[model samples]
Target chain A: MAMEAYQAQFAAHLPKAGPAWLADLRQAAAARFSAAGLPDRKVEEWRYTNLKPVQEQLFALDTAPVGDTPPALLQDSHRLVFSNGVLQGSADDLPDGVRLAGMAETMAENPGLLAGHMGKLAQGQELPLPALNQALSRDGYVLAIDPGISVSRPIEILFLSDGGASYPRNLILAGAGAQATVVEHYLGLGGGGYFINAVTEVEAAAGAKLQRYKIQQDASGSSHIATLAGQLQDGARLENFDLNLGGQLVRSEIHMALQGVGAEAALNGVYLLRGKQHCDNAIQMDHAVGATNSQQDYRGILDDHAHAVFQGKITVRPDAQGIEGHQLNKTLLLSDEAEIDSKPELQILADDVKCSHGATAGELDETGLFYLRSRGIPEDEARQLLMTAFISETLAKIDSDAVRGIMERLVGEWMAA
Target chain B: MLEIKGLHADVDGKEILKGIDLSIGEGEVHAIMGPNGSGKSTLSYVLSGRDGYDVTAGTITYRGRDLSELSIEERAAEGIFLGFQYPVELPGVSSTTFLKTALNAVRRQRGQDELDAVQFMKRLRVHTKALNISDDMLRRGVNVGFSGGEKKRNEILQMALLEPHFAVLDETDSGLDIDALKVVAEGVNALRGPKRSMLVITHYQRLLDYIVPDYVHVLAHGRIARSGGKELALELEEKGYGAFVSGTEAA
Candidate 1:
């Protein structure tokens, strides 16, 4: 079968093994990946987004390191390069009380902590890509913050794919009463066919706070699929935001569970697509305890023949009383051929919980357009203003200035083009 | 100061204003009273250059220039203002910011020096006080969550700030209470001078009490059928529009 070929190719390209547990995890993930294969239209979660483009391309399992990386792409932020899912260099200017090391080094130094939380956040997912990520992931960055410490600067993790299909798995664990912010960026080079299958897991202990930002800006003709899973303890807070501005066909999944009482979570995202690109965002939140709150807001702007899909769901357990949850997804279609499909759902078993979900898909308001035009603003400038305002409402929620500035610039450039 | 010769317009493919003619000189206030569906709104929209209201035939001359060739903003820059019946609600864009932008835009078009923040705020405070609008209204979004009466007063406040040479008030007094109406009319009357002209469009004679018109015209169907002095407004109010409607139908 085609899945066997991909698995064989992937196995041959993986880096040499470092330790027993790391090797065992890679093998198990590969086996699950081969058995499950790539999800198709029949899968309920991926019904709106088809993976045919990814399956049709022949991807090499190994990537050769770049001789000289392009300065234009890596000019803005501090670069953390990784090739073949292995960290190639170290980063400077790191904040105090924060540590970053390769996955192998962390596994050997802190086996108990890694074993307690790694791979536990994404257990029930049947997707082949996430399973493959867990099975074949190699050396990635590991960040650990001390208790009650807050870092002002954002820590950037750059995963680079030079060639072939690459899977970089990252694990982040925040200690009790600790606070920090991190940004995970994925980029590829050249027109050589590439695939980036990435997975990241975050854990926040009691009274801890974590802000995570993910940016997927890959090369043309490249395919990417990523999953971000998080677990929050009692009195902890987590804010997750994703900006998908690149990739020919990209699918992102975010799953969070408020496992402890008084915990809160916010999920915000924005996607800008043009040409023949396709992007999908799927989110799920579970309220397992009482007095927990969750909110999800996602917006998309599609042009040309591009397509976008948003699927969000909130589930409340029987004992999760006094829970407040809400979700909204709105899309703006710019071209006649552009398409957007949004699905929002809520399932509650507790009688004392409040939950609501809404989805809207429409074109620009003619009245609003005329009102702007009547004021002397050009048609193009008026459209740009409205689009910027729509996206800024979500971006303003970010707590970090540097991260929000980078996102605003990126979105502005995309909209201007 | 303003002239409309054989003005014809249509909305959604149906003709609304058919061959209408009117003219107003400087320092003159004219009131146009008409029954419902008499194309008063269509005339205002056409004059302001709002899209979707097709001006198929006719010529509108303002200050010796063809008004149809210019855009809404250009018309605004040329000192032609139209107070909308239903002002737009622009969330996240404060009323003060909107007014400042518009004021500077018009000023820039006229080759006038722009006002800085401090200078602009001073002028804005004076106008707000004259219109009896609190500073809180300017801080909030333009017309968002505003009551009907508040919206009308806001429109007048804008008129006061822009200081247009000629203005077309499109049913601005329809939803206002008596007190709000007097305030709006007072604001208008304060702006009246020898160099300015106004075209007040209304359905009833109540607004004419505060801002009395020098000339009164009755618009039936699409064209003006009768023109007289201010006493004509009282005559139309007492006799009702039945005479005008039946007279037109008979003709």
Candidate 2:
């Protein structure tokens, strides 16, 4: 089907009971997605990741699966489970100041909850994936935290798929001085073919802190595309860690704008790919104000015929002085056929600002391997140990020991498989 | 016991170890000292089955078995340990983790039960304390950002932990102060037993002074030019390696 046909089909499925404003917004977003169409190699940002695989398949909107509980991996989390783009049930074991609300239920109770902030942070729909998500998303959450309150518990959102296309949207707002940890788990059940378009918007007020963890372990026959956009206020901090270890094709585009002074953003990730999987991560960091800091550290382990791509862009405006930004992407290739393409870009228009970017792609270090082998470690075990050490360097930066442990264990299981 | 007959080796297609013959019996400590570019390190690498150090000729027999037939790790599992001159700095791999993995691997190959975390730690602490390796250093990455003395001590720590029957120390005293050298020598000395053997290769006789060898051989042009008792080390230290080099060239 053509782009317009898919948009028309998607528009036909828009819920008829929504308010007029939401219906109008959906129509506009549908038209925008149709106009933009699917991005191709000609698009510089999408050059390394071709969207032909997505274009070749036409999927209908999925119906909510019945009585699906949270996956075992998320049993301990205070979570809202979404099955096939429909909010199921929510549980709250969090602290007093934290609030987790399902968008569908919240919107039904109070129509004006999303009035000012629904599409405010994610205004730009120039990309087709985000535009498509905006047109068809029917289930997500509106998680908020009160000012001066710290929630020690983690808020998790599980998006489970059952072999069809689903669009999930999440909006997170942290009030002044509030802090919380959020985890987004995208999983595909039944080993079926599916397409997931996820869009998330985060707003951190002054002095607020937010740690976001995104884990993607979809089915091998699925395609996942997620768009993450956020803004930080003065003295705010954001730590976003992405773990990509599944799906046949995956692309995560992140855009973070530091609009306030003394704001900091740390974006780190690890991708373990094997078989014929392809994972691409594109990040854009905008330091629009002075005294803002940002760091991007991403590492990957690519094996077999898998391919990984990382393209990071950090821009400092002319007035944003005293900014410190560092971007790096390192990958370890485990097989002769595996491939990686990394590009770290830094654009600094302001003087007196420090910025650096680097990209390294290499095989295992021979000397390190020999050193381990000389101590009686077999070649295979020695190689795995060195590769794990390479990745542990980045995982060590994660402040939460529990989350880091889970991620490391997942990497270990992947290696063993 | 170890035996080498007409051993010839090359690195990067260039011959480094020419025809050489030597033998060491059980409980023997043999020292091979030579000047720079005399293939002291090459001989150690060949014995340990390192990659790219081609043995174009000759044979190395360990306990009546062909050492050349074993892979690097196989040779290590078979009780051949090489203490590197420059210990590899492995970031994110704690010293404790490395030692445990190495110990467990050798134990598994030898049909012995592997030690758990607590057992491994108890064994590690003994040697570490003897070598003056701090608890903080044991928790840190292996050889990462360690001082020169600390690196040498860590190598000896490995030697003590593994307790290989045939040990090869390649210039283990190259970058160490007097105090650190004494600690390292003490660690090596503690491991000496009737069933163990060692080949300590170095350029200077200073290390030999601390860990006296049963026999000392002067290696020149990839061949052992002279062999004698412990008194030969004192003789060479007084006259320097120039006498041996000239004598080997003249022969």
Candidate No. with top TM-score: 2
Best candidate, lDDT: 2
Off by over 4 Å in 1: A1-3, A56-61, A64-88, A93-96, A104-113, A160-164, A187-193, B112-116, B247-251
DockQ, candidate no. 1: 0.40
Q: Can you write out model 2's per-residue Cα lDDT over A1-417, one digit (the tens) per residue?
A: 576786667657765555778777778777877777788889899999978887744346756583556554633668788887678867667678777878777667755766666766666655778777777787787887889988776778888886677778888889999998888888777776788888898999999999999989888888989989999999999999999988999999999999999999999999999999999999999999999999999999999999999999999999999999999999999899999989888898999799999999999999899999999999988988898899998888787777888889888888778
Candidate 2 stretches greater than 4 Å from native: A1-7, A63-70, A92-97, B234-251
Q: Can you write out model 2's per-residue Cα lDDT over B1-251, one digit (the tens) per residue?
A: 89999999999999999999999999999999888888999998899888999999999999999998899988888999999999999998888899999999999988899999999989988888788889889889999889999998899888888889999999989889888888888888989899999999988889999999999999998888899998998888888888989744321
* Residues A183-289, model 1: lDDT tens digits: 88776676545777788888888989998888778876788888888889999999899999888888899889998998999999999999988999998899989
Scanning candidate 2 chain B in windows of ten residues, the lowest lDDT window is B242-251
- Ten contiguous residues minimizing lDDT sum, candidate 2 chain A: A66-75
Query: lDDT score, residue A86, model 2?
Result: 77
Residue A384's lDDT in candidate 2: 80
Tell me how far the alpha carbon of residue A263 in candidate 1 is from the true structure, in angstroms, after superposition.
1.0
